[model samples]
Target: MVKSVSNITPFTLLDYPDKSACILWYAGCNMRCLYCYNPEIVFGKGKFTFSEMISFLETRRGLLDAVVFSGGECLIHKDIIEQIRLVKAMGFLVKVDTNGSKPDVLQSLIEQKLLDYVALDFKSTRESFLSITQTDLYDQFEQSVQLLFKTNIPFEIRTTYHSELLAKEEVKDMIDYLKFNEYTGTYYIQHFKNNVETIGKLPNSHTRLENHLPVNTAVKIVLR
Candidate 1:
């Protein structure tokens, strides 16, 4: 059974693709990224019932085009397939936002044709991956990238650009790494936004502001 999560936003135009969709924010992430903005969900502070989410979705049946399962990490729950099926049964597209550490589960979902789109977050280069994510899943991340590259599913690779953690050169290195692995997908560079969670961890000075792009850049890779 999937763990019941909290804070269900029934309608959003930004979370999903071109169409409007609902987001199901799952609670509790396995990795610990220091700059995590959603510390409530990551630290297990949010709570919501699945039945409540279902009721909300039922009210917006024809209004929403997709159901985005975002989280602490949706794949962490074993009942992800069932949740996807339920969303699909409602005649809504399913999009999963994951970190791509659980390749086996992700591959099973793709093979079963359960997800239409996936957004995988790549924290940093393989060398600093463990330091950033606080996990020894460098090999798992590589495996997941390869699986997504071979799959028919459309997916995107994204990384949050926080000056404290990664430099501009390292961002380019990440893009080069993905290109080397034959991953022809959209790569989005999201900038770190300051909030309560990142108040103390971020830099106080603006000395390195000119080191990289000020805003995030989502570059689409054309796989040859």
Candidate 2:
């Protein structure tokens, strides 16, 4: 029922906070964001099966503290819950990186106590969701954001920034919405890194320049 794992980073201190962990990159995505960095993962075929992933994890059991299920939309896999359960049984904390499109799946996992941490992507404001993420699932993302707030689950919500894709003013609107909804956590504004593998390119003038965000809101914005 699972798809495939595109790649694996055997160890990383940066991926998981306060814990050493391995990162498993899953193949395919539900959204086609213009500034997506992992286009190959989103568009290409995967190399390893779920069994292979388990075998690798088995080798690293005593060394790493956690396993990060990153994507190309990791939650889209039908067998993710079962996979997470197995990983949790293996004595490793499990973290999932997602676009927040599958809130139902996220809720189910959180309720079952299968996840340790979640990093959800918040693409853009409600009005610009479609144009920014190139998907019709804005409402789902909003619901997922709200759902996480009510849960006892530890999580972080972030948005990748590119001046052309999401303007500072538009991001302010999104922040306002988050404040109105009482989103109590920090909102990350990650600078876009452009390269040949980028799914969609920005205008020539804006390509590698980080969006200089101003301080004007109640919500915390972390730059990455």
**Candidate No. with top lDDT:** 2
lDDT tens per residue, model 1, 1-224: 23468578767888776989988998888888877787778877546666667778889899889999988888887777787788788888999999888999888888888889999988898778877788888888778888888888888888776766776778777777776776767777666765546413766322233445333434463221
- Candidate 2 local accuracy as lDDT? 0.84
lDDT for 99 in candidate 1 is: 87
Question: Clashes in model 1: which pairs?
Answer: 5-48, 6-47, 6-48
- If candidate 2 were superposed on the true structure by all CA atoms, what would the RMSD be? 2.2
Clash number for model 2?
0
Q: lDDT per model, in order?
A: 0.77, 0.84
Which model scores highest in TM-score?
2
Lowest lDDT sum, 10 consecutive residues, model 1, at 205-214
Candidate 2 lDDT over residue span 95-196, tens digit each: 999999998998899889998888889898877789978889998987788788888777888888777777677877777777887776778877776554
Candidate 1: where are CA atoms >4 Å away? Answer: 1-3, 204-224
Off by over 4 Å in 2: 1-3, 204-217
